[model samples]
Target: MVYTISAPPHKKQRITFSSINRAKILTLLPVSLISIYFFGLPALGILLAGILAAVATEYGIQMIFKQDVTIKDGHAAMIGLMLALLTPPEAPLWLPVVGSFIAISIGKHAFGGIGSYIFNPVLVAWVFIRSAWSDPMTPLSIPHIGQFSDLLLEPGAGLLVGVSPIALLAGLYLIYKRYVEWRVPLLFFLTVFFFNQIIAFVSEIVTLVQEGVLNPLLYLATMFTFLELTEELSFAMVGVVIFGIIFLATDSPTTPVTKQGRLIYGVVCGLLVSIYGLFGNYVDGTLYGIFLANGVASFVEARTIPASFSQESVLERSYNRVMEKIPSALKFEVISDD
Candidate 1:
């Protein structure tokens, strides 16, 4: 038995930069595969162009900064792939390539290289291109998958109507591997439901008021009927929101590390996304939501910081902060024409 003993098993490398990057790639593969399958050559071209440009940008920027190259970590490539996937299928190849460069230079390098970046680099580039060249960046078409419905409520407008098994599986995989915390996503979906209901109820109320009906039960029926009709196709059911929550919003370096802090972060992001989508006329609010969430992470995290002698748990501390700010925020100001 001693002679037949096998060599000691190799120690599993715990979560590291490399593992995190690889997990992200795996999580996104399903989306990429499906896009390429449906969109054919154009999708492939955009994906390749973005990846090539990102790698080139990463290499060039590293040289410029005279920093040790970290392209092998696969982060640049991941960003490139995500950028391509997010771009409109009809977008000029140059758009993705340029976006890839900005993703590398401004989004990554400018923030002190890989792990130090404050926000999701892919989203940073997305916010830039979508703002500057809104035409090309906006999604033009949903690819036709044989008999599969394009799921468009109206041409080039409305929430998606189908659940994406690919995205769902990938997201589940990420959660299973513990690459992302469950609470961030769990709280996110909860807030999305709560927030969406509020928006839906309000919108229905306005419509009923305009149509001249004061019956609450009738209003409830009308609202529920409308919700039932489109519930399967609303923004919450759409693939993009699910995909973004799992992949983009859960970036380790960018999101809060504290367990309770993540809940607040997710809630804020989800609520904002709902507001933007329902009220602000944005096609997809997930992108902007994550960008804004990461930007304001400092404030969210600050509330969860453990006090030296204070008995406050995470929620207590955050609650105190909110209470402390309410008076100042609610203070009235009147301007006099002197």
Candidate 2:
């Protein structure tokens, strides 16, 4: 008699590759439709090009390497969709194809595929496209439709997702579905806001000092007012922080695992955003910031993970040394039973 055996994972997992990918596609599809409606044929063409290129590239690579084909898993399609969303509407049709190829071939597979990429594949493609063809990738002009229509659809400029409020709703849905942790987005927003306020305050203080004004309360009031006005005028900033926070920066494998490490990772990404967006004057600062943060995620996890029982001996030795430093009168010795 023989016993049939199965691979590990005898326990069921609540989250899975298909589930996560499906959730993302569900949310991204609406945004894609909205973008197509607003941007017209060019937008649709880019999306199709990106998705097709990504799928074909993945299929070809898997076949060549004799690996199991996973293109049907929707991960490749999701990457393509995301890359299309980040692309400018005026970008050439060939642009998306090139970007998708890089995303699937180099960014995804080169690092060991699906879960092993360090940077967000979409952003990786965008960086290369932006660097190589800065002229064609320039931001397109968005038509402003005043009044109630603005609430439903506000077309500002830049990337497709950058101009859509629908992206925010999709991000919220992703959070509700538990596909992403709320902490990272929360910390990221708080950090961006905190830094913005600080910068505003410092600027106001310098102006007050130059003007020889003595009333500090007046300066505080002025700074707060200015910040409020700035927030209203710079509504486009939402897409930068929210889109990156909810999707790009929160990739499970590329981000920190433990709670404390995630918090730290969030803060690090936030600071980088502040630095690049505010000081450096970069348009895609949010993407770049999150990409850089991915590099440091492993370090954060290494430091924040709790010491296992195997390392307790080292901790015990340290404790014993501390105890030895105390005087015999102050130290309590363990009495052994003979």
Candidate 3:
């Protein structure tokens, strides 16, 4: 006689709303704290105002549309707060509030809420604000440890613009532990770094004999790698790399679902950013490049590949499809998975 005991079927773990919200708040808090410490109360105030505006806007939109408000999702409001912190301190408080409204009401909701937006909401707001008010967006003064004299001692002193490292690291850690791909950030930063080095080399050669000529590439690289790369003030390049990989590139709605598609998407964003920096006069071109790439990725996804295809084939098919769609356009394709 043979007897066997049957085990119960596995049940999926449900993440409660409270846990999700708590996690979001914890993720955002580190950046907020760092911003307050370095940039002082004004930056903190802007962040708070943006969060309030984002939450209010999201609620109002949900009410009007008769949809469930996912303030618990924490993405919309957090994006707004991040956008606000990224802006220059002297920016009018109203701009960030407006940006929050634009980000949620138009960028996120108008496209079909959370996962529907074709671009990063924070990037959308940043581009809008920068275009609308170019002057005030530029850094006017360096953030210091409560002393103006420090500016004289520090060579790279400038008001830190962009996300804090601590916040970025925490956010990325959570995201990566959830199994998000790391390639997006790696490709993006590597592309930027490579192009930046080229720009630096050329500029250095051009200005070798000139006196007091500051290297724009070095300055910009430092800024991009430090503040723009992460969510808080820290020296860990890993945080920057992780943020770019997970947060910037793993935008599920905007990014391609396939690994190959994502790699292409990341590469395009990196190239566009490099081009923007090399040619465009705007300082915030990286954000714009990402926004544009997001749109392109979405368009490519909707038209290019069949749902049943393998990831590699889908990427190959997308390349052919894109080429077919625009004969005159340059064609870029993935040759191998490795």
Candidate 4:
């Protein structure tokens, strides 16, 4: 018997598109179930519609192009699942179906499919649908916590009504240990908090001044009392910002790879979110902010990638630079026996 083996250690890579997508699906499964728990059967229906549409769209596109089928890895399904999470629970049946088609056709296939796309497919669909049909995508007109006067004023209450706390915890864990960089999510939440506190303080200050009671001596105390510590916690804890940072902005192909670049991306995206939430008409601006950040990710990556030496004489310059700092070390001659 003759065996056509090339080498002793003939091993293939353990990582692949299928594995990546599988991990993503598993990670987001809890969040999806949680959403269904809060929103009931309607959420499930929308989710199913999104999945079927995405899969059909990918298969249809492949057929048109006469290319190999690309639906085996669950990439399309993941996109669909993400879209379902982002979409309004009461969205029309055709909304997810159309959004999934556009997400697959234009967001993925237009950029040569999957890894080549410049932005997350679900986010692309979000922008498309939001611009076309504004009302359906917006938050519910009814307040979720109207009875509770303290929590009623939270901006995200309508959108994330009855959202579970575990979803947020799971999302944080997912991003912390995922294959992609963690700084994007970490910095994003941090920046959001920083801005939240700043805005809350400014609002309180403006109110105090308007009421003719702005006290410079007790400004710090006023800031501590009326600032973000208690005001936005409900909004932040509820699903959207945490979910967006972990699952949406942390996309491996779309987000910056370098640590510094990812930091910049996260900060900018978080800043945009704060601006839109506080000033813009929208209660949640993650979709717009992430889409905008994706548009400029390449620019951030170019400037923030760490400096690396060429393969040739890689550490020679480093050794020289170190030796230059120590005159006594330069006097010693080192000879290599090899």
The candidate that achieves the highest lDDT relative to the unseen native structure: 2
Best by TM-score: 2
Estimate every model's Cα lDDT from 0 to 1.
Answer: 0.73, 0.78, 0.62, 0.73
Candidate 1 C-alpha lDDT tens digits along 65-154: 788988899989989988887786678899999999999999988988867899889898988998989887767543222222433212
Candidate 3 per-residue lDDT over residues 259-332, each given as its tens digit: 66667777887788668756752234556667778878965555434556445565577677767887554655
Residue 311's lDDT in candidate 1: 82
Q: What is the Cα-based lDDT of residue 120 in candidate 4?
A: 85
- The TM-score ranking, best first, is 2, 1, 4, 3
Model 4: CA > 4 A from native: 1-14, 141-162, 210-214, 222-228, 281-283, 308-338
Query: Between candidates 3 and 4, which one is better according to TM-score?
Result: 4
- Candidate 1 TM-score to native: 0.79
TM-score of each: 0.79, 0.83, 0.67, 0.78
TM-score for candidate 3, please give it: 0.67
Native-referenced Cα lDDT, model 1: 0.73
lDDT (Cα, tens digit) per residue for candidate 2, span 1-338: 99968997574548778788888888877778888888899889989999999999999999999999998788999899888888888888999999999999988999989778887788788889888998887675532324334535666646777556545567677788788887787787778777877776777788888888898558678656654645533422455556787888888878888888889888998899878877553347788888888889999887778777667544476788898898999866799999
Comparing 1 with 2 on TM-score, the higher-scoring candidate is 2
Tell me the deviation in Å of residue 149 in model 1. 5.9
Candidate RMSDs in Å, in order, are 9.3, 5.0, 9.6, 7.3
* lDDT (tens digit, per residue) of candidate 4 on 233-279: 54444456656777788887788877788998989888887777666
